[model samples]
Target: MPDRAPQPVDRQLPTDEARDLISLVRDIAQHEIAQKAAEEEDAGRFPREVFTLMSRSGLLGLPYDSEYGGGDQPYEVYLQVLEELAAARLTVGLGLSVHTLAAYGLAAYGTKEQQTEHLPAMLGGGLLGAYALSEPASGSDAASLRTKAVRDGDDWVITGTKAWITHGGIADFYTVMARTGAEGPRGITAFLVPGDAEGLSAAAPEKKMGLKGSPTAQIHLDGVRVSDDRRLGEEGQGFAIALSALDSGRLGIAACAVGLAQAALDEAVAYATDRQQFGRPIADFQGLRFMLADMATQIEAGRALYLAAARLRDAGRPFARQAAMAKLFCTDTAMKVTTDAVQVLGGYGYTADFPAERYMREAKVLQIVEGTNQIQRMVIARHVAGPETR
Candidate 1:
């Protein structure tokens, strides 16, 4: 089956420029991305060329500083672009989000010299990046990570394995966190490591149910050395940096989840209206109508939540709680909506002939990545209830 083009999302943009940007993104998604998305994803083929084109077109670095070869769009605008792309293909949308996350440390916390040196190429010069934070032993309890980065005269030697790293093998740069002192979050430090650094290796890609076009694998940093200049923020600040990136990254994930849900809703509606049963279209059934209505409502709610969080970020205000809530709600909505889309199609949806099954499988991952929905609840509760006292 041919890949379905992303239906336009009715966006409430802040400016004419934002509207034009969304229009451009929709054009690209319809012509370039959606057309090849299904086939490429089915083949588990990574579209490096698409990313290169995005880099050249300045779409890869929206929401970063303009001086650093970035588009300088606000987070709200940038996120809607992500939503459109995700509706076209989850791999492309989520890959771009990870790249943006990988650049967060250098953009937000790097020294002037480091920003001038690396941010430009990283943001738009055809270079891809990955963030390395979750270790094999520390998925949810990230503060308990075991990766170590020991100071060696004028350099740091990094050794440990990072798990579930997107773009693990193909990334050109990695923003890595490692233990530098005592146990726990305070001891963590961040480093910028080149993917080709000596002793850095990526294990085989995971055979995942969805987003297979994107490589998820274990990254081994065995005695990988980087000069002191490559360190991101101050020593013992890696966990904080990681958290900051994730707050923003959660919004990206929320946007992707909303887009995926929207796509499923659109597919369901199209199929329901076109496919007839009992001498009438399924869309005429009140039960199916309620399901579609709920799906659309959830998608709209998730989109609004992510946009609200993005606006808060744009205003330099506190938004962590909102970001966490958006991630939790939007991802869960995606899982629900995609599941309903499969049911709307019945047996036909269970097969690979339709994209509903793929959307369902893809939606499952959004709940797990960035942070598990359970972890997102903990984050939200921490903000809502304050840190629990002994």
Candidate 2:
């Protein structure tokens, strides 16, 4: 028999409204996103229309204040919605996460006037955003970025190349970190640069191992100019703003990782129950069953870890350490679970005819994005046992 469709996750939502919201998200995932995920991803096609639909449906700004076109959902509810989207398609889920990351500086630190003027359009008006912090010379050491933003009267002229920007070529706006003062982290400033500014451009997308449907490219700002009003937060405070945004962004990545691992586990289970050997389904074998069991356990643990971190965030408490721990563990779980899923299906898992191979490939990137697992470890270590002395 053909593999059975995966069952819906039995989520422990806080309210009837939250449950209803999950139901709506699941319906969209099943009907609108999941149906063409494989085909579109294989073809490297970005699903702009799906994002448009999500914006219209109020899914784009779930964790922000409703006064500014946001859904006003807490991080816990929002992360669950992200999990559903990611289980259907990682491209969509991670894309939404990147959009939220890009909007964070403005939403969290912008002046009231800035929020009143721009938040509505960005939150729900069908605009896509990109976060630009990584440069050609700096990835994990984002504090060392050399992108220059020179003040000229009331405008800032930004010039440099940002590497590995999600939605680089296609974003409507970008939250860019550029050096505006001396050297090092304290010199940085964040700007809200329009994607189509005079000298802003993106190079061809990178040929990545996974998430091909989501464009990751080098964004070049050659004297790109933005008015002083477009600056996010105070000048020389960009690094702090970026770090604060990343704490929440790591949770988003963790939720997406759990979702990806869940999908892999579901695929593995379906294959095990249907594929036969020795006159019985492979699921009857103790070894394969054990693998499945382990995969499931890891996924559940990862889900719990990310949700606990999300709850901490929703409560307005310090969660950077928990967020780092969640990112590290969940992404590691995704890589392990997806690889074991590939092993479960044997030869068939290695082919494009099934999704197991794609899941494995996609799982690898989760370990590296937002911040590498190595970076996460450092973050956790700092929180637990004081900063390392140089």
Candidate 1 stretches with Cα past 4 Å from truth are none
Residue 364, candidate 1: Cα error in Å is 0.8
Q: Give the per-residue lDDT digits (tens) of candidate 1, residues 1-390.
A: 766899887788989988988998898889888998888999999999989988988898999999999888999999999999999999999999999999999999999999999999998899999999998889989999999999999999999999999999999999999999999899999999998999999999999999989999999998999999999999999999999999999999999999999989999999999999999999999999999999999998898899999999999999999999999999999999999999999999998888999999999999999889999998888888888688
TM-score, each model?
Answer: 0.99, 0.98
For model 2, the stretches where C-alpha displacement exceeds 4 angstroms are 1-6
RMSD of 1: 0.9
The local distance difference test score of each candidate is 0.94, 0.93
Q: Candidate 1: TM-score?
A: 0.99
lDDT tens per residue, model 2, 1-390:
222233599899998989999999998888888878888889999999999999999999999989999988999999999998999999999999999999999999999999999999899999999999998899999999999999999999999999999999999999999999988899999999988899999999999999999999999999998999999999999999999999999999999999888988998888899998999999999999899999999999999999999999899898999999999999999999999999999999999888888989999999999889999999999889999998
- Considering summed lDDT, which 10 consecutive residues are worst modelled in model 2? 1-10
